[model samples]
Target: MTREVSRTRLNMLRSYAAHDHRDNFQKAEMV
Candidate 1:
C-alpha cells in the first residue's frame, strides 16, 4: 500500500513538472 501511494505521488509530480515546463515554454514564445 505504501509503495502504491508513493508511485501515485511520483506520477503526479511528473505531470505537474511537465505542465509547468509547457507553461514556461509558452511564456518564452510570447516574449
Candidate 2:
C-alpha cells in the first residue's frame, strides 16, 4: 500500500514539473 501511494505521488510530481516547464517556456517566448 505504501509503495503504491509513493508511485502515484511521484507520477503527480513529474506531471506537475512538466506543466510548470511548459508554462515558463511560453512566458519566455512571449518576451
Candidate 3:
C-alpha cells in the first residue's frame, strides 16, 4: 500500500513537471 501511494505521488510530480515545462516553452515562444 505504501508503495502504491509513493508511485502515485511520483506520477503526479512527473505530470506537474511536464506541465511546467510546457508552460515554460510557451512563454519562451511568446517572448
Candidate models: Cα lDDT each: 1.00, 1.00, 1.00
Instruction: Give one digit per residue, the lDDT tens place, for model 2 in 1-31.
Output: 9999999999999999999999999999999
- Considering summed lDDT, which 10 consecutive residues are worst modelled in model 1? 1-10
RMSD of each: 0.3, 0.3, 0.3
Reference-based TM-score of each model: 0.95, 0.94, 0.95
- Per-residue C-alpha lDDT of model 3 across residues 1-31, encoded as one tens digit per residue: 9999999999999999999999999999999
Q: How accurate is candidate 2 locally (lDDT)?
A: 1.00
Provide the lDDT at 17 for model 3. 100
Candidate 3: Cα lDDT at 15: 100
Model 3 alpha-carbon miss at residue 13, Å: 0.1
Clashing pairs in 3: none
**What TM value does model 1 have?**
0.95
How many collisions per candidate? 0, 0, 0
Supply candidate 2's per-residue lDDT for 10. Answer: 100
Query: What lDDT is reached at residue 5 by model 1?
Result: 100
Error of 1 at 24 (Å): 0.3
Ten-residue stretch with the least lDDT total in model 3:
1-10
Which of candidates 2 and 3 reaches a greater TM-score?
Answer: 3
